[model samples]
Target: MKDDDTRIKFDSEEELIDYYCSKPHPKAFTPSIVIVMLLCSLVGGIIGMELIVKFGLSTNSSIIGALIAVIVGMLPMKFARKFRNIHTQNLVETAISCATFGAGNVLMVCVSIIWVFNKPEMCTGILIGGVIAFVVDITMMYWLFDTPLMGADEAWPIGIATAETILAAAEMGKKAKLLIGGIAGGIIGTWLGLPMDIIGVCGLGNIFALTAFCIGLIMNGYWPTWFGYSLGDYYVPQGVMVGAGMVGLIQAIILIVRKYKGRSKTETPKEELKTADSTFIEPEESELTVEQENELLGEKDEKTGHIYTRTTKQMTQTFVRGIILYIIGAVIMALIGGIAAEMSEGMLVVWVIYAMAAALISEILVGISAMHSGYFPAMATVIIFLVFGIFIGFPPHALAFLAGYTACTGPAFADMGYDLKAGWILRGRGRHVKFELEGRRQQYYAELFGAAVAVVLVFIFYRSYFLAGRIPPVASVYKATIDAGVNGTVLRQILLFAIVGAVLQLISGLKRQIGILFAAGLLITNPIAGVAGLIFLTFRYFIEKKFGDEGRKNLNVVSAGLIAGAALFSFCTNTFKLVSTNSKKG
Candidate 1:
């Protein structure tokens, strides 16, 4: 509506260039963002580590965590127009990097699976594997992801969503108010879930941690029967999952009814028809064609759908440099791995090399998948890596490490690439960091630093929780499964579904999140939640039709808050568990 609004509504990359180039952005990473990032990083690490340890799931909808971090991080710059979008972009970058920020997911999954090998404790050997992953992942992120991100056309859906959220945060509109409300709601929700016994009275049933509450509700006479059938032995998850879905469905149906019911009052006859005219929601793909974007990049993509790619010579150099850095990093890792192993069995060197080789192959496969489809079969890749490890005749410790570490490190490169992809689109002023890294962007350092912080904090928590006698049974289950490989688990069937999921993504060009839901629907005994999501989104389409961006932003804010609140509670509960148990032991 305003001159600034006109500029901000970028229709193409040229518009982006005009808007960004018009501004002489003075500051890089503003101080307010930095301070908030530190807090976010700490919280993210704690929560992220705790999730894998306790629940084996991180924030599936990453936007929730990103929004939570932004709210908690006090992203004051995003609200102030004086600060460039690039600065805000950097803030989002740090927030996201710090938030899930660790290879912790891999470590938790790996260690938990093979806890049998270590028996009473987690293998220190795997810590070395984590170290190897952390270093190699970082190296790839710093040296290689810039190129990958530059070329890919995948939606990078979460990254784009975060960027859009950041954009919304900057707007002095209802969007900002909704985001503020979401933050407040999330905080309140988290407070309500605080421990009554331990933290004194706020402890209550949580929406996310529904297992105990779900069963308790059933066992405590909430429902003894359903439709003339006895439910006493029907399993509580069935009811809980059903209740969760119904709750979602009720909200959606109400919203849809309200929208169409009210629409008649606001719409003129002509306007109603105009609104009903055919509308195509843009695919979450490039706004510019490859040819058009080339005009902006000063480099044409000889290959279709890829942009800003390196020449063959440049690609070769990047490869050589990446490998050289990897080899050096591997040496440091081998030493740490040997230490973690507490013996020179030579598996450390072998596993590191194995990880590198697997990661390289995965980087191409998964990276391409993420770049073009926003769907990388991370679990499938890990399965393959584990199979490779099985062939290598790795001991339980090394086997678990190889599979999990490969899974973690390769996808990390993809994650960084997506973050950078968003950054590239937003156009960060690539500030020189050091003489040795003269051309590097400050955000790259920020990402690298985040990587280091996340690894340290998560590993510390991982060790601390283990010391406090938290043996994540899920990981132990994985370990048991790994021991037998195909003979041990139902993984072959799951992998089949996962591969089908990948193919669906490839063929339909659906987002990875959808594929994930599809996979879960196939494998899990419970799929009521997915059904609820589908119902909610179906309702959401009508809401968007009625209210557009304002409606969506509002929905995202409330949803993000609800989801993030649950995550906060989970983290705090886990952290308290470790602290209290450790104190008792002391």
Candidate 2:
């Protein structure tokens, strides 16, 4: 086995354990690390807000964050040495990532909905509600991650891309050159108006899912020309998401229930030993001494086939708690946003229930799509719920609150999953249970701190942007939809396609994620990207078939470089454009 700078090539499980036990991992949240995290958070938060408000998009900034940590580690100062630890870099990446979504996705989007609705007075209330929803969003994913429903084994292509970037930078060999070359290619490709990120994801994600997604994208682009009508004319994408999302949620519940039932039937008696004294079974290939091997032998967890730091039951409870919190937040938003004044008693009750359900359901749909293909249609998902709200006769003011609250959920949830997946890889893929859990907890804390910073920044600066009439452009779409109102014809069209969506999801099952990815692609109009994804998927299949896992792994590394380079280029160019525009205004 070849050893990398970031990880050791342990000879055996016993050796891996002994090595980790002897050398305590570096602390993730040292004072020095926090200072770096704060800087990255500020930069990422500002860039994310500017990009979203100016261009209607936000990039994953974790690659940029990891790059900053690497630069800091290279500084000659002794104090900067702490940044060299891969775990510390992971935390830094988490901070910037959390802040980016916290500001652009949650805080700005929420406040913009109210401002765009001409209800600027209610921005404060909506902002508070958004913060609460944001917290619940991250907490829900933190607990539910690694479960069968949102398993760590899923593609999570963005996370994998970020991890590979970090590893390449740290190791700095042939892989690093591949990454650099890929990054250059990505920048050049993107400059030519090609979708480099999609191509990159095609090399790393599920082939079947991406194929479906690319087909949907192609259909979306050419639907009017090919079929003599626009899909959005009848809300086809929204209808598909509605049907697929419901089925997807049901599938998740079924998975959890099945796992619980199977585990219940084969329950095991607890050993009379504590966690510290607990033993583990050794693999046959372990090259440990006879005494060491004997000492490590023990029974595995009969419930789960392997050791996990967190349990399934705990994740389920955490999800329930998150839903309850979202319900309470919805109530608060209704009372504070003056929604209570607009609706009757029965209607108010219905509104609250609908709001909470919309937020959670959108998160599930977005998460599934992102995990499968690194593409989440967050705004489109919210609009689906918005259509439903209009169908239920929600007044414009009430719909504003609904859109604002629900809009904050899905992006934050998906972003958190990406960051966590990156950390999971850096933490030895959960092989060291205690270490992985502790590292994850530290990452969570870093995210909270970053979110806190974003909230403060938005509170201070959001009004300036609104005054300049630079609110997120999506807010206008929501405002327009609320004004247009839903008609009987549109509602009928939605209902008709929903069944088709549900059937597709059911047939695909949870593993393929075809239905959700198809909906994701349909929600965004970009034919060139779809074409790029198809081409790369074909190329990736040929490489894997000819060269095997090693070739596949190398291809994934180059793909990561492509994604990172494209994202970095986008951020820099956008930031420059924003600054230049702001300076002229000043």
Candidate 3:
């Protein structure tokens, strides 16, 4: 093998950076990753549905699924000598969104329709509502985030932090290696069909959601295509899991026999650690100080030394197009409702006007909120929807459409704004989020694919979960709120706050004032992240006190490991539970 250790090696860090950053990897956001993402999403949807039905919990599903997806999606990069950091981020983004949408949106919403309103018959209405929400949200994202807010580099603190984390992990430091170990553990668990019940014994719930899915399979006494693209569907031999129990049993016995015959072996700890250190991956340094590179493509204001991302005319054009789309979408919803959903034109007009107002105003607030807090103000959005619904008299289909539209759109805008800002942070471009327009176009393409797939998955899951009789209490409550009788007083109060908030935001733009107050207030509202931040800071402080500045620096590397560890724990536990349940059933 020509002495593998001496075959090739970089002499210095600068040479290493040049080698990796010279060209991008080809594995990002391709069909291969897309398939992996879809499979994860299917599993996530099933797990989320399982939790909701069994324990009325779904909040942690998105985060857990996203983390796992990140690990699996990045596994290929472990072997790629030319892998780029941002490409790994893209794979994570694509896979995580699928998992999130599958469980968080589709199954949960379906459960709400059936359980909350006792209206499983309103399936069509649900789809309509989701479509309208998606459309409005996409429009709001384009108008509020990518254009005017591109100049607002610090708009999303969380995105910036996340991008930094990804880059830090890419350096293949101790933290990155730990994260990789966690990912390996997770893959092992999945392959072995492990169960996650151990965590549940300690009241740590939702760790074993998909783990028991095989039990669901066993009870079916059959497998159907309607179950979606399950892992076993294509991966299992004999074309199905129907009789795989016997095969597993035989393999288990063989493994037992092998274990008895084979002696245990272990590598020397010192040598393994030495090898690990020698193989550590390092990332290119693309981040630049302002003085290093100032020829960025964004325009600068000559008089004030300020950067203007886009012209006022461009922003104006974006707003006009968004408004036009909003109006047309509403008209289409109304027309569709008239034909099949029993929505009157007058009611539709009322809902559309209210949706337009709510979407426009809340888009700004949500975008601003995202910039300052590292979160989208989802609660505020629901309140906005409810308040607007009260003003519109809560007409059936119109109420559904408006509620879904406003509640969903603002948060979408917030995510887009944050992600764009994150991209800028990672790519280190002052004027643009990406150097290549193709990357931007790819984002749009991936977004459309994800969105379209989400709607379809939602539709499929709506049927599946509804048939399974899983009703979402929160979703039902929200749905009932939409279907409830209106109170005029509530409308007055909402309007009062809305008008005041709008005026404040508008005035702040001219004076550049609200960013500070809004940022401060936003941080205050996020007690969980705030407390979490304090804990991390305290931990870091103690490390510095004990070991000086070097320990503080190492914390950056360790953070990624912790994230991957958490994800690995979840994956192993979940898979363990599945294997246990499946074995028992078999």
Candidate 4:
């Protein structure tokens, strides 16, 4: 037999481990870890529901609670790190992260509904319904599917989790059981095992696990059949459907043109040297050491000095550039918020336009700048939500916000997919693997399930409370605020400024015009108070642009600090108000 050492061309054992550790593993978790993470998720869900009920679903409450949860959950892991082996550490960290995401998602849904309905008492019934559903689903899955698939590899855990949840619901003779099972399976599968597998390999593997889990749930009647294909019912208005179709046709034409050009080039055998351009580039390959190879092949990369690799300078540069674009995009959004506050009527139209424009501008900027990508765009979208909600007012219906969020997240998700692919390539994972497609499918199904569940609960609660004359004052209070007008002039000015800024950006080729637009918009809204905004914008531009590399870095950090500080202040102030109100009532 050929020598084992000579058979594999690895630089070192450490290299083999490192490479293997970076690739996706089909079976990354033991049964115990899965159980623990699922339990953590249940706990997180309970805590999240309690907070949502107590605090109401205001922006401040959501942010503060999420922040606290993340900090508390992560801090313990740092100390426990010393005792953990590599796999254990990954499992623990991944579990925490998954739990955090799940908790936030649950909290947001509850709070969003309350905000929409403006009812505090309604929270009790909905909370009870949601929790009962979740618990029942989890219990059923654990008893049936989880036990049988305790040591199953590949997609079996997901299949079992999903199957058991569905089967349990069927046995109970409850349609809601299907929903509960799906949600429970999704949360446990993605948050616990999926993350470990993805992180253990190159993050790309998570997509597969997530996909399998979602598919399993769907097969068990946990997901809606229409799913993402229901775009027409949700998004497209009858009148505008034709226009949307035209846009798709145009895009298809462009795609065909590109494809035809490529085919022509390939058909024409070029004897001449082809210059590197956007259309063509040399194939780049990454050379991995023995540890990296081993990791890709489903081994572990011990944190030896020789095994671990530092993040590349190019990646650092990309991150920095992305951050800069994100900040600029945020400032623009803030200005829009101020303007939207000024609009008296047709606010929805104005809001929709602003959202669409912001999405387009952010995408264009990120696309033009090679260093930046979807990360900055995602940040901008979230900032836009914050600015609009606080300065103008949160949207009455979740649909509008959901539409904008979907638009923004689409590109961001694509960017994340590409980033994972890069990691997979670097770690020597299979090239043919289509994990992102699976992730997308999973997200679609999850959203469908969530929406369906929410709709049913909302209807039930509305009938039970409002139609039956047990209505609370929450809706009335919200309506009264809307009638009184919550700083409409500010929103109008912000919108005007964004329009002016966009026009200037298109015509003048001057990026500073954005700052000018913001300053002028704020000034128009409140002349005396707006000076501070002007000063800040001016100082930021001059200090950052004129200074050396160190100066630019300092300014960037300072700007980020300012945004973070303001957000923190707003959150604390809002929480204090809620507490004071509760105290007074008590």
Give me the candidate number with maximum TM-score.
2
Tens digit of per-residue lDDT, candidate 3, span 345-446: 666566667667655655555554445433344433544456446654655545555555555455446555544554444444332222422243344444
Writing each residue's lDDT as its tens digit, candidate 4 over 275-374 gives 2112111221264444333222211112211111111222233334433443333234323323334344476555544444444333323221111110
Candidate 1 regions with alpha-carbon error over 4 angstroms: 1-33, 60-86, 92-96, 107-116, 119-125, 139-152, 173-306, 309-353, 363-380, 428-440, 472-474, 485-586
CA deviation > 4 Å runs, candidate 3: 1-21, 24-31, 44-89, 106-121, 135-146, 150-152, 155-158, 174-297, 301-312, 337-344, 360-364, 416-422, 429-436, 480-586
lDDT of 2 at 169: 67
Winner on lDDT (1 vs 3): 1
Error of 4 at 202 (Å): 24
Q: Listing every candidate in turn, what is its Cα RMSD in Å to the true structure after a full C-alpha superposition?
A: 13.7, 5.5, 19.6, 20.7
- Span of 10 residues, lowest total lDDT, candidate 2: 291-300
lDDT of each residue in 65-132, candidate 1, tens digit only: 34554454343443444333544444445545534636345555555544556643445555555556
lDDT of 2 at 481: 86
By the lDDT metric, which is better: model 1 or model 4?
Answer: 1
Compute each candidate's TM-score over C-alphas: 0.57, 0.90, 0.60, 0.31
What C-alpha lDDT, on a 0 to 100 scale, does residue 500 get in candidate 4? 39
User: Could you tell me the lDDT of residue 474 within candidate 1?
Assistant: 51
Ranking by TM-score: 2, 3, 1, 4
